[model samples]
Target: MKPGILVISHGSREAAWVKLVDDAVIAAAASPCLSDIPIVSSFLEIIEGRLIQDGIDELERQGVTDMYVVPFFISSGSTHVDEIGQAFGLPWLTDLEGDLGTFRVSANVRYGLPIDDDPEIAELLAANIAELSTEPEKEALLLIGHGSKEKMFHERWQEGLLKLGERLRALGGYKRAEYAMLLPDQAAAKLAEMQAANPGEAVIVVPLFLSRGYFTNHVIPTRLTGLEYRYNGKAMLPNQAIERWLERQMLEGLQRLNEK
Candidate 1:
């Protein structure tokens, strides 16, 4: 009845995107502390043979009686996260404003939180922008993400990013920190406003995506066509910090179970 770690992500057809997640898991699994554990990285969709259920089945096949599901998403506001919970026969949503409630699974399930405004994540953002910054004190930081149009869902993005923005500004010493969303088509306008508000200050665009896929590869560039800004198109992946984040979550879940 040993525990296994199942990392769930929003899948993509892009081989590169899938590889990023796989590499992160591989790196984590290589760690001395986790080398003995059964760690499988799976996706929600778009991969050929790997899906959430496939991951669950794999863990069960490995003789895992307790599975820790680490949802590798940008925000808990994602509808996909809720759907994944329901797919496992867990309560869909007892409280939308708070953490997505735990669910009942074939195996004892321990769910982990999404990467929402964690200080480590904020450090990643600052690092991405720092590469393009000449004078952070004169530049504006614009953090963009796949935001929701729905009222409550959008609020989640706003609140999370606002905290992240504050953290990024503090860490990077930027003149100001701001946020833009793609859902309501506010990214373009927001970028323009940031520039207008601080004339001559460079704007560094940081994408808050889990991987460098379609949106980061194409859509974001397409959307920012007319604007002159600095961006490296880096997504959160292949970072050891993420593996540490997953480990910390798994330990917390394990501790709760031990207490009970």
Candidate 2:
């Protein structure tokens, strides 16, 4: 049986946003280590025709009987992550309230972890922020997340961002590092508060997101409009580190499958 991969991401209406995710998956699949593997990328929602079920069907059509699904999300605590797990009939670490509906595929499927607070990912985030921090000693780093508004979902988003914030803080160059969500009425106030608290310090705002899209480009900037901070609206994309991370996950998945 041929082994294949299905890369899942949160779908977007913006063409640029979808392209970013597709590009990353294509680049990662091109790696020599991932050679000959049929890797299909799909979205959770929004985009028509290229949904997660579509990805599964594509893999099955290609004669693949064993499939590994790699969810390319920023947080493990994301409800989307749980929803994807349930879609694959896999037990989740956290209870997900929403249903993405049921999917039936002939291929045996295994799920991969989201881009959680992995040490390597922390390094990637640090690199992205370090470039924005002109003076690490005097600048404060603020990481923004696309948190949920729903009570159950919001808590998970907060939990993951807070943990990531701590890791990013420990990366050690900044005066202070904090995280805030776009929802639950905290993002703008937090940004304003950070700037006010450190009158002279440069507040570098980095988004805790997977790619540069509507949220990173439009929403975040609009929310921080009156705040005094430096934001280039950079996201975690066009980085080789993410491909490396995916490769590791695939290899780990293969190892686990082999063990079983």
Candidate 1 C-alpha RMSD relative to the actual structure: 3.2
**C-alpha lDDT score of every prediction, in listed order:** 0.80, 0.80
Give each prediction's root-mean-square deviation over alpha carbons: 3.2, 2.1
lDDT of 2 at 107: 84
Error of 1 at 157 (Å): 1.0
- Model 2 has an lDDT value of 0.80
Instruction: Name the 10 consecutive residues with the lowest summed lDDT in model 1.
Output: 95-104
Question: How well is each residue in 1-260 modelled by candidate 2, as lDDT tens digits?
Answer: 68888889898887877887877788777878779888888999997789988889888999998888888888766778887888778775555445777787998888888886788888888887776766687877787887777666677777777777778777856777778888765778997787777788788887888888888888888888777787877788878888788878777766665555
Residues 85-174, model 1: lDDT tens digits:
766656655343323233334778877778889998788767766789889888888899998876666888899889999999999888
Q: Give the TM-score of candidate 2.
A: 0.90
Off by over 4 Å in 1: 94-105
